[model samples]
Target chain A: MSYGFVAPYTALVIAFGVLPALYAVFLAFTDNEGGFAGIANFTKVVSDFRFLPAVAHVALYLVIWLVALVVLVSFLAVVVHAVRVRWLSRTLRFVFYLPGALAGASSVLLWLFVLDPTASPVSGLLHLLGFSSFVQVIVPANLPPVFAIIAFWTGAGGWIVIMYGALNNISPDVIEAARIDGATAVQIARRIQLPMLRKWISYMGIMSLAAGTQLFVEPQLLSQASNAIVPNDYSLNQLAYQYAFQQNDFNGAAAISLLLLVIALALSAVFVTRGGLFEKD
Target chain B: MTTVDVGRPARRRNPARRRNSVSGWSMRTIIAVVVAIFVLFFVIPIVWLLLATTKSAHALIVDNPFQPGSFGDLAANWDQLFGFQDGAVTSWVGNSALYALGALVITLVASIPAGYAMALTEFRFRRLLLVLTLIVMLIPNTALVLPIFLELNVVGLIGSPLSVILPMAFFPFGVYLTYIYFNTSVPRDLLAAARLDGCTEFQVFTRVALPLAAPIVALVAFFSFVQNWNNFFLPFVMLPSSEGYPIQVGLTSLLASTPAFNPSSAGAQSVQLPTLALATVISVLPVLIVFLFAQRFLVAGMTAGGTKE
Candidate 1:
C-alpha cells in the first residue's frame, strides 16, 4: 500500500533525477567513443582556457550574492516585522515579493533597459556614475555586482518573506521575558531575535550558496545583450553548455556538471545534518 | 510554533508602558525610512518597464524615462507585438499555459501521495528515498538540464513537449513540502483510529488524511505552477524550434531582434523598444495575476521550509 502511494513519484525521480545524474557520471568518465577514459575528461575540462575565469566569475558572483542575500534579506525582514501597521507590513512584503514574479530569464530581459543609461528611469544617476551606455554598465568588471543586483531583485524577496515568517514564530513569552529583564528593543533584536534566527540564517546561507553557484540565465542573457563583450563563457553552467552544444564535448560538459553536482550535494548534506534541517522535534 | 506579538500600535500608546532609555520614536523613523528606500528601489524598475510600453522607441531614449506616453503609442506597440511572426506572442503564451498546466498536474499527483507515504508509513528504504529526494532537490536543475537533454536525445524524446514536461514535473521540493506538512501537522492516532474502524490504509488516506491536506495541496500547486511557468533552461535546451518556444524563450528571440541589443541582426522585421517592452509585460501578466490572487498560498509555500517545528 505504501509502495502504491509512493511508486509513481519514485519512478519519476529515478527516471529524471537519479538516471540523469548517473548518466552524467558515466559520460564524465567516458570518451566520445564510449571507451573508459577515467579522469581524462575532468582534466581536459579543467585545462580549457575558459575554465579558470569561469570559476573565478562564479566564485566572485556567489560571494557577492550570498552576502547580499544574508545581510539585506535579514535586515528587511526584521524591519518589516517591526512595522506596527498591519497593512503597511503586508504591503512592504508584497512590494518586495513583486519582483519575484518576473524571475530569471524575464527579469534579466527587463533589466537590460533598467541598466541602459540612455533608457533607464534612473538615467540621471547612471550618468552621474559616468555610465553613458548599456555596455558601460554591463562590463566584465561590473558583471558580478550587476548579476547580484538582478538576483537580489528577483530572489531576495522570497527569503525576506521566509525570514519574516521565522521571526513571527518566535514566542511572545520569550520576548516579553527579555523586556522584563530590562532589554531594549535593539538589544532584544540583536541578542534575542537574531540568536534565535541562527538556524534559519544558516539554512538561507547554504541554500543560497547552492543556488548562487548555478548562476546562468542572468549572465547568459547579458552576454547576448552586450554582443558577447561579456565572454560567452561568463559562468560555469554556461561553460558546461558551450562544451555540450558549441564544441560538441558532452564528456567535458558532464564533467563540469558532475563537479557542480558534487559540490551542491556535499553542501546540502552538511547543512541537513549539522543544521538540523529535517530533524523531528 | 509560538505565536509572536506583532507590536500593535494601541499597546504602544498605553501610558502604563515603560519608556525605553533609547528614543523609540527615532528608531521607528529610521526603520520606516530604510524600508521606504528599499521599496523605492524595487518599485522603480517595474514602473519604468510598465511605462516603457507607452512610449515610442525614439521618445524612450530621448525624453525623460519616467514620463508617460500616450495610449495611442501603447496601442500601436500592442498591435506590432501581436503582429510579429503572425501573432507569435499569443502562441508562445498558449504554449506556456499548456506546458505549465500539464506539468503541474503531474507534480500534484506525484508529490502529494509520495509525501504522505514518506511521512506517515513505515516502509523499507524510506530513509534512503528521503535522502535521495533532498540531494536531487539540492542539485540545481541547470546542472541536470544538459544530462537530461542527452538522455532525451537518446530516446528520441528531444524536441517533444514531453521532454520539457517530464523533467519539470520531477519537483522534489514539492515532495519535501508535502512530507513536512504530513509529518508535522497530521495526527498519527487519527489514522490509527481510522484503521481500527475497518478502513484500509489507502481509504484512510483518501478520506481522512487527504481532505485535511488541502492547504498543503494548494501551497504545492501554486509553487509547481510558478516553477513550471518560469522555467527557461529545460525548455530552451530541449526544444530547438522557435515555434515550440514558451514565452520565456520567445522573449529571447524578441530580445535578439531588438536593434538596441543586436545591431547586426536587426532588419526590417526588427522589434522596437516599445513593442519589446509590451511583449515582456504580456509575458509576465499571467504570473502576476496568479500571484495577486494566490498571495496566501505563496506565503505558505515560501515559509514552509524555514518554519519547521
Candidate 2:
C-alpha cells in the first residue's frame, strides 16, 4: 500500500530529477559523438574567455545578495515581531511579503523602469546619486548592486516572513522568564531570540546562497535592455545557455552546469551536516 | 544583577523594570522608523508601476512618476495594451493559467501521497527516497533546468506544453514539506485506531488522515501554484514560439518591444512604457489575488521549513 502511494512521485523524480542529473554527468564527460572525452570539456569551459568574468560576477552578486538578505531580513523580522499591537505586526508582515508576489521575470522587467531615473518614483534620490538615465544607472560597475537590489526587492520579503514565523515558533515562556530576570527587550532579542534562530539563519543563508548562484533572468534581460552593455555572459547560467543553444557546445554547457551542481551540492552538504538540517525529534 | 538582587528589599526592582520599559519605548520608536523606511522601499516601486499605467509614455518621463494620470490616458493605455498583436496578452494569460493549474494538480496528487507514505509508513527505501527528495529540493531548480531541457529534447518533447508542465510538476520541495507536516503533526495513534476499526491502509489515508491535512494541502497547493505561475526559466526555455509563451515570458517580449528600452527593435506595434507597465500589472494580478486569499496557508508554508509544532 505504501509503495502504491509512493510510486507516482518516485517515477517522476527518477524521470525528471535522477535521470537528468545522471545525464548531465554523462554529457559533461563525453565528446560530441558520444566518445569519452574525459575532463577536456571541463577544461575548455573553464578556460573560455567569459568563464572567469562570469564566475567573478556571480561570486560578487552572491556575496552582496546573501549578506543583505541575512542582515536586513533578520532585522525586519525581529523588529516586526517586537511590535506590541497585533494588527500592526500583521500589517507589517503583509506589507513586507507583498513584493514577493512579483518574483523572477516579472520583477526584473518592472525594475528596468524603477532603475530609470526619468520615470522612477524615487527620481529625487536618483538625482541626488547623480544618475540621470537608465543607462547611467545600469553601468557595468553597478550591475552587481543593481541585481542585488532587484533580488532583495522580490526576495527579502519572503525571508522576513519565514524569519518572523520562526520567531513566533519560539516558546513565549522562555521569553517571559528572560523578562523577569531584568533583561531588556533588546538584550532578550540578542541573547535569546537570535540564538534560537541560529539554525534558521543558517538555513536562510544556505538556501539564499544556492539561489543567488543561479542569477540568470535578471542579467539575461538586462543584457537585452542595455544592448550588450551588460555582457551576454554576465552570469554562469547565461554562459551555460550560450554554450548550449548559442554555440551548440553541449559538452561545454554540460561541464559548466556540472561544476555549478557540484558547488551547490558541496555547500549544501556542508550546511546539512553541520546545521543538522535533517535532525529527528 | 547583584544590585538588583540586593535592592529587592528596597523595592528598587520596580524602578529598574520601569527604566527598561522606558528604553523599550525608545527601541520601538527606532524600529518603527526603520520599518517605515523599508515599507517605502517596497511600496514605492509598486506604486510607481501602478501609476505608470495611467500615463502616456512621454508623460511617464516628464511628469511626477508618483502622480496619477487622467482616466482617459489609462483607458488609452489599456486599449493599446490589449490591442497588442491582436490580443496576445489574453493568450499569454491563458497559457500561464493552463501551465500553472495543470502542474498544480499533478503536484498535489503526487506530493501529498508520497509525503504521507514516507512520513507515516515503513516502506522499503523510504529513507532513501526522503533523502533523495531533500537533496533534490536543496539543489536549486534553475541548475536542473538546462539538463531537463536536454533530456526533453532527446525525447522530442521540447516546445510542447508537457515540456514545461511535466518538469514543473516534479516539485520536490512540496513533497518535503508534506513529509515534514505529516511527520510532525499527524498522529500515528489515530491511524492505528482507524485500522482497528476495520479500515484498510488506503481507507485510513483517504478518510481519516487526508481531511486532517487540509491546511497542508492548501499550503502545498498555494506554493505549487505560485511556483508554477511565477516560473520563467522553464517556460522560456521550453516554448520556442511566442504563441506558447506564458505571461512571465511574454512580459520579456513586451520589454524588448518597448520603444524606450529597445528603440532599434521597436516597430509600428512597439509597446509604450505605460502599456508595458499595464502588462506587468496584469501579469502580477493573479498571483497577488492568490496571495491575498492564501495568506493563512502562506504563513503555515513559511513556518514549515525550520520549525516543529
Q: TM-scores for chain A, candidates in order?
A: 0.96, 0.95
Worst 10 residues of 1 chain B by lDDT: B1-10
**Candidate 2 deviant stretches above 4 angstroms:** A279-281, B1-30, B307-309
Per-residue lDDT over A1-281 for candidate 2, one digit per residue giving the tens place of the 0 to 100 score: 99999998998999899998899999999999999999999999998999999999999988898889888988888888888899989888888888889998889988998888877888889989999988899899899998999989998887788778888888999998887676877888899888888888888888888888888999989998888888889999999999999999888989988888888887766765566756332
| Alpha-carbon shift of residue A24 in model 2 (angstroms) | 0.3
**Candidate 2 CAPRI-style tier:** medium
The prediction achieving the highest DockQ against the true structure is: 2
Score candidate 2 by lDDT. 0.87
Q: Model 1: how far is A269 from its true place, Å? A: 1.4
Best by TM-score: 2
Model 2, residue A159: displacement in angstroms?
1.5
Model 1 bad stretches (over 4 Å): A279-281, B1-30, B306-309
lDDT of 1 by residue, A33-136 (tens): 99999999999989999999999999998899888888888889888887789998999998898899998688998889888887888889899999998888
Write down the worst ten-residue block by lDDT for model 2 chain A.
A272-281
